[model samples]
Target: MTFLAISGSARRASTTTALLRALQSAATPAHTITVFDRVGELPIFSPDRELPSPPDSVAELANAIADADGLIVASPEYIRAIPGGLKNAIDWLLSCDALIDTPIVLAHASHRGDDMLGQLRLVLGTVSTRFNEAMFLRVPLMKKTPEEIARLLSKDASQTELLDFLTRFAAYCGSAD
Candidate 1:
């Protein structure tokens, strides 16, 4: 399965982005995980601007999502809520057919951010029929450097967990098809 792992952080050195990158590295050859860490590049969504067609960057994101078998989203909590950039990306996809039936799951990078997670669950569930609320992976890698995250996730135990999670999610996505 090809999964688009989206990072919801705008910061260059974000733990959320690092976590997605780690997942991308851990994925097996059969399961291609593409990490999209550029939500910050998408233009602010506007309904009027979407009529003629959305921006090039937004279209590129939509195309990537369309090509993927499933989506894995990781984000950081901001002000006890979803980050604006991530939400804006979702808004751009709201009217696009690519997201309506796409399978989606959440992978949290922090031990905290339950608030943001809850809201993401609600939003994603609303947007996509195949959003798997029951399938989740939460690794406590907050405040860790990218090097530290890579080292930690490269361990045998962490690799097992990541592979297991991907296997189950792949099955779930297959079932939907």
Candidate 2:
């Protein structure tokens, strides 16, 4: 199975990105996790620009999501809400067929982002009918370096829990098809 992992933060060393990297490294041989690192490169979404010929970056994002079996999104709350870049990227997918029934997993890398998570749930719920609210993952990773976070996730217990959750999600995605 193939899962597209998108980090909603634009920072070079974001914890959200780090966690996705760890997920990529920890995935089993049967599964492939590909991280999308160019949310920042996507243009602000506009309906006028979405048809006929979208930007290369937007087309690429849509194609990636269309090809993946499931999606894993990790976002860091900004000012108590989802970041603008991530929101923009999602907006670009509003008209894409791929977003209609794809399975989605949301992860937050902050201790307290319930407000943003709630909003994300609402947004994703509209985009995909199969968005699994139960598969959400949250880890308080503020102030930690990527290396440090990776080390913690590498521990047996943490790795096991994450892999278990992903395995279940993959199974769910498979059955949903």
Considering only N, C-alpha and C atoms within 3 Å, which residue pairs clash in candidate 2? none
Which 10 successive residues of model 1 have the least lDDT summed? 17-26
The CA lDDT at 109 in model 2 is 78
What candidate 2 gets wrong by more than 4 Å, as runs, is none
Judging by lDDT against the true structure, name the best candidate: 1
Best by TM-score: 1
Against the correct fold, how does model 2 do in TM-score?
0.96
How far does residue 133 in candidate 1 sit from its true spot (Å)? 0.5
Task: For candidate 1, give the lDDT of residue 168.
Answer: 91
| TM-score of each model, paired residue for residue | 0.97, 0.96
Kindly list the per-residue Cα lDDT of model 1 for residues 1-177, writing each as its tens digit.
899999999899998888788787888899999899999899888888897788899999999999999999999999999999999999999966668999999999999999999999999999999999999999899889878988999999998988989999999989944
